[model samples]
Target chain A: MKNLTIPEEELMLPGHTACLGCGATLAMRYALKALGKNTIVTIPACCWAVIPGVYPARTLEVPLLYTAFEVTGAAISGIKNALEATGNDDINVLGFAGDGGTADIGIQSLSGAVERGENVFYIMYDNEAYMNTGVQRSSSTPKGAWTTTTQVGKVRDWKKEKKKNMVEIMVAHNIPYAATASIAFPEDLIKKLEKGKNIKGPKFYHIYATCPTGWRISPSKTVEIARLAVESKVFPLYEVDHGVYNITYMPKKNVSVKEYMLPQGRFRHLTEDEIKEIQSEVDKDWNLLLEKEKWTQSLNKVQ
Target chain B: MKKMLTGNYASAYGAKVSKVKVVSAYPITPQTTIVEKIAEFIANGEFDGKYIRVESEHSAMASCIAAENTGVRTFTATSSHGLALMHEMLHWASGARLPIVMSVVNRSLGPPWSIWSDQQDTISQRDTGWMQIYTENNQEVLDSIIMAYRIAENEIVMLPAMVIEDAFILSHTMEPVDIPDQADVDEFLPDYNPKFKLDVSEPMGFGSLIMPEGPFMEFKYKGHESMNNALKIIDETDILFKKKFGRSYGGTVETYKLDNAKYALVMMGSTASTGKEVVDKMRDEGYEVGLLRIRSFRPFPKDKLRNYLSNMKSIGVFDRSYTFGYGGAVFSEVRNTMYGKNIPIKGYIGGLGGRDVTMNLIEKIFLDVVNMSEKGQDKDYEWVGLNGDKRWSQ
Candidate 1:
């Protein structure tokens, strides 16, 4: 069995401004562990833009460059290349942004960076909506979920579209490493981040972070809800290395998607038939992911 | 070396001699060959710069923004829809005070998708806080780009600049351009050393949010002050460049035979060349008319224009673009500038959608200027040549 121990370094200083039980906070905490003090994080306008407090009181131990809302990807590429030009090529340049920034406004620049094969790490902390701006629906927001933009009201509501497949999109770029992680699985997340550190090209991480305020869940259930998210297979943990898929953690016993949704007030209006329908969709996607891993492993064996 | 080259190639040569450190590019009509030449320069090891192949013009400008923030010289080029898409990032470039230089080939915007010459493409971006300058010839295009860097990167004036040339008229048409040697260019333009940047050890944040009544207004004031100072620096650089290279375009507004003439024709871009040809022909015919060409639009050169216009009895402002319900873009500006004066100033709108602004048409416009001056009758506005369509005349 592999050792699943995480690093003890706390690059995220305490006395910061993140909300209680914010999974994005934990996501940054662990991401800093993977990329240590020798890292520079370039962030777009999102929740993290304000989480570090105002100037003279910023909580980040490492340097942070806050850029325009849709420019984190292009900013990282420019930063990395400028560092290379200046003879400081050994540091890691990480791009951190939210789902709205990653999946919608920022995808063009992100596509440009990966297409150019820039040496940088892009992390999309997916809380599933535009949480910082009062919980609006984003492209990464799951279908049938209630948001400010997709409100559950008479004559309309709830996100009709499915969540955007960001990991698959990164994998389509033929990037060296693309992974899906969760705040529930820190050891697995850290392990994948460590694996990505050894890779030389562009790496992407789509981390499933739960927004208690956005999801209308209890603050105390942040970790528990995230764990249920994985066990329910709604948020699978996997990595693709050069088109080879690897399911990092396979749940021993699958939980019902209902168990995952019943506690969150965001989905309180979901009917029984609606829950069963979402269950079928989750199962179908999980089976497809399993087949991808199986087929990729078989191809590796053949080669 | 002196070589006959299109205006696009001249733009690329200007960037090469300026020792640009990073070039982010997206291909668009007329501007495509400019980026292609820069790429070829990079591939041939003649130029040492990072060539970023962006997906769209937005990323191209975004990449240049960050690259310039890192204390290095950056450049890019686009036209038409590509430039329209970069509108958002163009404000960011100037608001953050990154002195990025971009070449805007003046192509008409689409609906009918015509890739022809029109000044409206650049005129639409007039309020974006970028220093806009129009070039008359291939040589002036090359020189203005270098001058753009010198003026933009000046400590007092840290803003982005746009060098615009008419599409196909200059971009595709070849003319003799004197490409200066590296040593002369090196002596002229020094290395860019920014005062602040994204440094890990130093740890400074850029583009932070401030409240409405906060430092926002003051920051805007500083940018405005810097822009107002560009006019003086432009004059200084023009004198210096002339001393070194034997070519000088008399600061922002270039005048020809306005010494004792009572009537003058005013315009910008390559159209000024056509206008100047007719002015000289009239001078040889003893018509006593002069030409005044505006090189810089952002600074507007009100004082220089006022000094000259204060002398002329009648002036005709020529604009290739109209602003709908209002007068022509340049004509409106000139009229507003000459508002307090009682001179008979008429506006002639012509040469749109790549329509020919023929020598005969220019001669006729000047002839009308002479006739209008004699009767002291000034028509507020008129479309010069539109295939003589009489429906609008009614």
Candidate 2:
């Protein structure tokens, strides 16, 4: 166990409007600690858009720009340019979007900014589905997740597609920094973000945010469920720097995907066969990542 | 310190002189060279800025938008398909009111795709709240960018500006352009000082959602008024630019021998250069023909357009892009400008899909306008350079 001391200065204060034990709220709290006060955040149409509260009474301590669901990348980029034009280069320009906003609707602009290597940090809090619009299936929704759009019944239909690998897509642009972090692992999440601050060019952090309300789970189990996701290898914590891959946190005892899926009501309808299939898929992805890490290591040695 | 360059180089020079702190861009034809030159400048240490090699046109716009919001003088360039991909963000940049300057090399849209000279792509984005300025030549391309920053960063008009030039014709074609000295440009256009910006010390909300009919309308109305107010600033700044750089193109509207001329041709972008040549040749042939070059599109120059065309006996509008089913895009706008007026206006839809609008085509347009006015007849929106077999079979 690592000794992690949390920062004292809280940029995101309590008593603001957010669901109890909201993973995104906690994500914001930790993200703000790494970003500090010298940051301006642009948020698009997502749960965070509403969670920030209405004008005259907002929660976020940083300057926030709420843009349309599809234009967060463009808006944040504009803000970043405006900041630089005025000779203020120290402030961090952060874009906070949800899975739906980042992986689906905003993907074009996101890819554009990343390819351009815009000096900005984008944090996408993935709750798997479009939770703000009533748990519709987003591209980030993993296979076999039960959402309103991908319901389970006599039809036996669940999300059939795998979650879009946004980190890889970002890395394909040859972005300087990209990492996957989770709300359950605050220490790891904070460390990755702190490390990201030093890297130039576009930095993307994909945070696995748990949604108790949408997931139909107890609020108390949110963090536990998030941790189980990492431990089960469903959502591995990893970082990619200039195409070099490294797994940030390797789980000690590899837990079955069933153990992680069984606790969540979202995946409750999955049969044993389906669970096994998911486990195999996770193993395949893990092996692929391991190969990439090894290949990067060899390249570094040659260099 | 001084070099004769093309309009594209002038724009790059202007960005360099502005000491642009960041540049994020993607490659598209015509516009590709501008970014390529900048990349070279950055690599060679000719320009001091962080040049981001973005993945797509969307990201290029996003990166510049983000950089601009951070109070940096950021620059980017794109054209045609790239601009279409950036359509969604075009509105975002304007609505957010970030004064990010972008150079759009006007190229014909794809699918029967051709990368040639035309004003269709930029003209299509007229309603995106961006202050659009069309250039007749390379000099205007360079000067318009420097002027764009002034108009965009103005307290009233805190919207992004697009400096548009015809692809290949102006973007690729080389013409002598006086590259302004950095010190002269600095004295002419001071450092950008944003009225409102993203700052951590004084946290403020930006681009926040507004109820459809409430503050949204207020903000939109303000944007409209700002664009309207920009017309005067455009002229004022052009005057200042000339005083500083010793060059000017009569601001938003440039008239080529229009005084006492009974017939006139109106257009924008690089095609205006061809129109000017035609007008001169017609004058040499002892015909009373003139040319009106529309420099500003967003602040559409309605009054100036009306004032110039209202007195002319016959006015011909040459459009490079069609509005599909309707007449030419610019022709429609030109007609709309003269809706309640007594002037005889004829619309000629021509040079689409990057077709060349040569001096001979301009002469044909002028003749058509003259015949239409004399015969009191309106030809049902015709396409130039189409023979009987090539004309629509329908």
Candidate 3:
């Protein structure tokens, strides 16, 4: 018998309204397995706001609070402080927000919470764009991607800007722990959450959650596409501990960025030249992460 | 015990005596001292609660809403633009039925930047479903906080409340206030033990998405019912607070020598103090005038306004905040309450942006109402002390 790495208890019930093979749903399921039942989750205006089945029929086994679209950080801070005030500091306060809720409209509140060193876990589930509002372009949307707002017409109106670096933004706040994980790697994702539980201050996780409907990919290919994202170095799996970076998973086999972009229909209109441009950007980012890991490790040794 | 406390300190003492478990707030002028005094209390070990120093007023209200959801009482204070920033979460707090109480120091909203006393800040938030109490002096500012929590936390009327004090008239002015003992306040307003909270043992989702076919409108209808329930509960709580502390605020509407007057003045906030003084001087001169002060602006004492103003020959409503396209916010509501009545009700817009509503202005308003009644003339409203000639003389 093989040793099971994931917990068996399912805090997210089976009857949620998530679409078939929604990567954000699986990301939540694995996060709950790591956080356990003693956690209170605060969700803002994101897909999970509606995914947590309608009133009188909730999906999460742990207590959940739905707040306004941009107040997830403040809400979680309130929940944690209130719990401490009541002499019950053992309960974990978790803020689960979508990328649009984190990197765009919610950035100020998230930055404030991290700067205050709030004792909470903030998870930014990156579906790349506003999937709940029908695939509008968000600041987290990658370049050369087609969205409702960033249309691919004759003039090529796809998103032209790079995706916002949320993990680096969290790191700049000097948070205790900040990591990037994906739905494809449940073990690495769960390990980061469990490690964050033992830390005393704010811990942030930027999870690459794929959107099958928005990306125009087959529903069953959600996790596979997410795995290709990491393998192509488009979304690396790494964690920063006290300003020191460590890449948790490196691709054993070289995978081109074209392999990750070819399957998703959002990038179908991109020309070879545009894909090459994105590929070079991804390589540059991956090399920078490697240098950060090496340079910060040396700094730690000198200390 | 007696203490010369500013309205801001009174707000802090109110929260302290109520044993509020959480204090989350940001600083804005006039309202800054309230949170500063609370921070001072926390620093001196006098207040045994957690003060979450939020970065902005939107976060302040957001934090208070979530803190209250954890089944603990929470307090926050803001003024002017800070309150404007919190407008969205004010609705969120009441919609979730969190029963959070906030101190709103009423100040003028700015385009030209004025941080003075006016009802515009709290008046603009009248429809946010927060029960707003416009306090006249420092004592009522403190007392209303205790009563507001009791009314808002009632089982049938779960809502948020705002204890409003005029920017500098009350917020910065010091007056003797009776600070209640903690033991007595604990008896008057017990611990907030909500039936449903974010508890791990008994997990449940709050404010989840409801489809059109679900009870979405029903939830809003329930909010209306709860607000209606709050009216009666507010009166009951005021009476109970009086029994415990030996003072009462005359329930939604407070009247002064209004029984036998042919013409009367209707107003709110600190301007009503000047109105009372004007009423006394006019009565001595045999003008048959009195005063009516509106304390609670939401659950707006409609029946009480009708009951008090129906017999008067004419009425004057003094509003510090204008309703743009209309005469005055309170005047519109008061006129609507007196529908089909033949009384010549006139609105007087005055004392805006912290300009003083002096005894002369109040007397002038009274005489104008009296002259309009004598001639059976009706005008919608007039702006007092405009200084139009000096500002725009060609």
Q: Which numbered prediction scores highest in DockQ against the true structure?
A: 3
Model 2, C-alpha of B281: deviation from truth (Å)? 3.0
Docking class of predicted structure 3 = high
Q: Chain B vs. true chain B: TM-score for each candidate?
A: 0.97, 0.95, 0.97
**Residue range A183-231, candidate 1, lDDT tens digits:** 9899998888888778988999999898899899888989999999899
lDDT by residue for model 3 over B257-373, one digit each (tens)? 899998989999988887888888888899899899999888788888889899999998889998788799988888889988888998988788988788887888888889888
Give the poorly placed runs of model 2, Cα more than 4 Å off: A1-4, A15-21, A65-93, A101-122, A164-180, A195-204, A227-259, A279-303, B1-4, B388-394
* Model 3 chain A weakest lDDT span, ten residues long: A12-21
| Candidate 3 clashes between residue pairs 3 or more apart in a chain or in different chains | none
Would you list the clashing residue pairs of candidate 1?
none
Identify the candidate with maximal TM-score: 3
lDDT of 3 at B144: 93
Evaluate residue A19 in candidate 1 and report its C-alpha lDDT on the 0 to 100 scale: 74
lDDT of 3 at A201: 94
Alpha-carbon TM-score of each model against the true structure: 0.95, 0.88, 0.98
lDDT of each: 0.88, 0.82, 0.91
TM-score of chain A of 1: 0.97
